[model samples]
Target chain A: MTAAVPNAFDDPAYRQGVVELLGLLAYGEISAWERLAEDAKMAPTLAQEAEVAAMASAEWEHFAQLRDRLFALGEDPYAAMLPFQPIFQRFHARTQPEDFLEGLLKAYVGDGLAADFYREIAAFLDAETRELVLDTLSGTGHSEFVVDVIRDAIAEEPRVGGKLALWGRRFMGEALSQAQTVVAERDALTAVLVGNADRPGAVMDLTVIGRMLTRLTEAHTERMDKLGLAA
Target chain B: MTAAVPNAFDDPAYRQGVVELLGLLAYGEISAWERLAEDAKMAPTLAQEAEVAAMASAEWEHFAQLRDRLFALGEDPYAAMLPFQPIFQRFHARTQPEDFLEGLLKAYVGDGLAADFYREIAAFLDAETRELVLDTLSGTGHSEFVVDVIRDAIAEEPRVGGKLALWGRRFMGEALSQAQTVVAERDALTAVLVGNADRPGAVMDLTVIGRMLTRLTEAHTERMDKLGLAA
Candidate 1:
């Protein structure tokens, strides 16, 4: 049993931080949806395109849920998402996938990274917001599809694995750089992560934050390994 | 009450015709989904992009339903869709939308044309197949959104109306030409339309087919009128 509106919302800063986090998450979904849809265009076959398109639709559905939550919180969803657009745009621009395999690797690796980071942040959020964040961040149930496709491709051509492995590293680098920019610019979101003075119980100390990063990296490595790509 | 599988499907030729028709319709949806997703990228704003993305997802949903029906009929969904892919590809290649407004108009008017044509064909189908065809052919509910957006744009720049009107005509021309090629090449699909020797009752004579064409054209004109464009 949980409160529909958490007591954490009583603090104005906490509420603002949650709103910013939701905005970021929602925008991330929209960005993922757009990129996946674009990747579907380069799919090698119609069946593969449909699979990617299904993933895109799943992302859109998650975005809609986050958007509705923003509305319920009395914020303009689009306006909330506006500030983070350029960060994602730059990340996507710098890491544009050159082919179908690159696209699959990016979708799997990039999304895995974002989901890990968000799950860490969800730890500091109120129950309701945490639940929403975790639920939406859950994979679109296509990770196996990506893993199978990439593993088969790599098996067919040993050289392709080397290229995709390098691609994964580049995607992670770009994602982290963009993420750091967001953290530096968004005080409210940073407060949510490290926990502000108003939310003493949620405080994550420097060591804890460091450990979170290690966990994220390890998870990413595991995903890359699953795809037969080096981290 | 309707039969789960129509008695009409008992005839091998009729079954082949329906399978071919479903293949064509499913492929049309996948094609529309791809094009709509492309159109979303050209959207002027994030909100508009989401709207278009929603329409794309709607198209994908229709494709899934049709694909499932194909599977139930012991057909490979992708293989069913393959034969008609080139026809749609050619149609899309010739009528590529040049901008945001053109994309919107193309989505609205082009889908309207396809929907009208399919509905006419649905009349010749058995009750179950007719229901599926009609259900999927139904608009994605974004017609009003497209109408409002295009109407506002034309209002802002009166010249846009003239340009879009011409664009509308070009889309219709390309669609009709591709449709002609399909009708000429697909003997089974044509059999569905004209009523084959085996199914005397389902046979639509030349006059009826001509009237169906007239109705299709009138619907297209009405849809164009709704968009404040000439048919």
Candidate 2:
């Protein structure tokens, strides 16, 4: 891909596409923030609650960065964020965690999946926007803390491993279904992901998209295994 | 206060009391985080939701600070936080925000009252500990965002003012009662707040306690008025 240029943003459709991606991400962070905070209540200890809240708040910081980018692009940050709300809400409603461990697995697995997907999509974006999106996804925070907690939990209760492994599968399924729903609705966003002619970098073929999904799946399985869950 | 010396921590009882107080504040931040996030779901717009989440995340940052302080004192942060769980849970259960506006008022008024109460108590501590608590309580993140939203809502619907005012009163009553429950249960905490004979600063009597409550109440009223609600 050629180096990104300000001239790319000069194209109104390209600007709108980038704005849409940012908006999708901004709302995604808000939804993640709410879910993680809700899960914090399920934490068995204050430290764990703090850990989850910390991750949720970290996600909000990313939300702010995205929103700021929207403003810098001369767009309404909230309006940009509004359209994708239902998509994320639907995803969360379907994958609601049943317990602290389930919540941990969801956070760990869900975050990893989203990060992988975004990283894959970034390949089709202009360098600046790609960097912004990747940075936002970089550490949406449910990191080592969730992993340690989930591993310790499965070790203590072997039955938990089976349940969470099932939960992990369910989380992945609901997420993919929601992604399909969103892609079906958001023509502009889908075009950006699938590589529209004017959509920044090299256009992606069906094969590339397939490979991306495969990579995301492999990453999800690895994360699930690390949590002592059967993928 | 004689310049805070390392010797103060050398007094095991004082150290224990400080640890207890940090635990209370840490748990308090987590509770605030949960409530704000819950309230975020009630927000009428994505903007409002982000605002509430922003405040909740800020509270989590404070939780980290308090937790770090606990660790610095060689205490297990979660273990220290455990004992105060029920107290905050009881307080939250009683003062739950029924909707977005009520949650805004709670975040605004409740935060103000807690900040005032903590500031008053800080007067009884060694300089270092006083500074730490004061710093954590400094900007509880319920400032322009909550006040602006509440003011706008009440301006649009004056009747909400009356209900929120009453809600504010109930919030105060519940908070005080829960605090009383905590003080009655944790003698070390009470000693830290009211000042034990062998404690650092001057001992507080009933009159002083009454005055502290008065100060917190006055601050609450001011905040309520800012929110366009009567106290």
| lDDT of all predictions | 0.84, 0.80
Tens digit of per-residue lDDT, candidate 2, span B33-101: 888889888988887887788788778878888889888878899899888888888888888888888
Positional deviation of A33 in candidate 1, in angstroms? 1.1
Q: On a 0 to 1 DockQ scale, where is model 2?
A: 0.78
TM-score of chain B as predicted in candidate 1? 0.91
**lDDT value, residue A8 of candidate 2:** 63
Clashes of 1: 0
Candidate 1 Cα misplacement greater than 4 A, ranges: A1-6, A197-207, B1-6, B194-207
lDDT winner among the candidates? Answer: 1
Q: Quote the lDDT for A120 in model 2.
A: 82
Task: Provide the TM-score for each candidate, comma-separated.
Answer: 0.93, 0.91
lDDT per residue, candidate 2, A1-231, as tens digits?
A: 456645667676666777888898888887887888888889886667777877888888988899999989889999998888888878888888889888888888878887888888888788888898889888765578888888887789888888988998998888777776766676667667766737445554556556766788899999887777888
lDDT score for residue A74 of model 1: 89
Predicted model with the maximum TM-score: 1
lDDT value, residue A138 of candidate 1 = 82
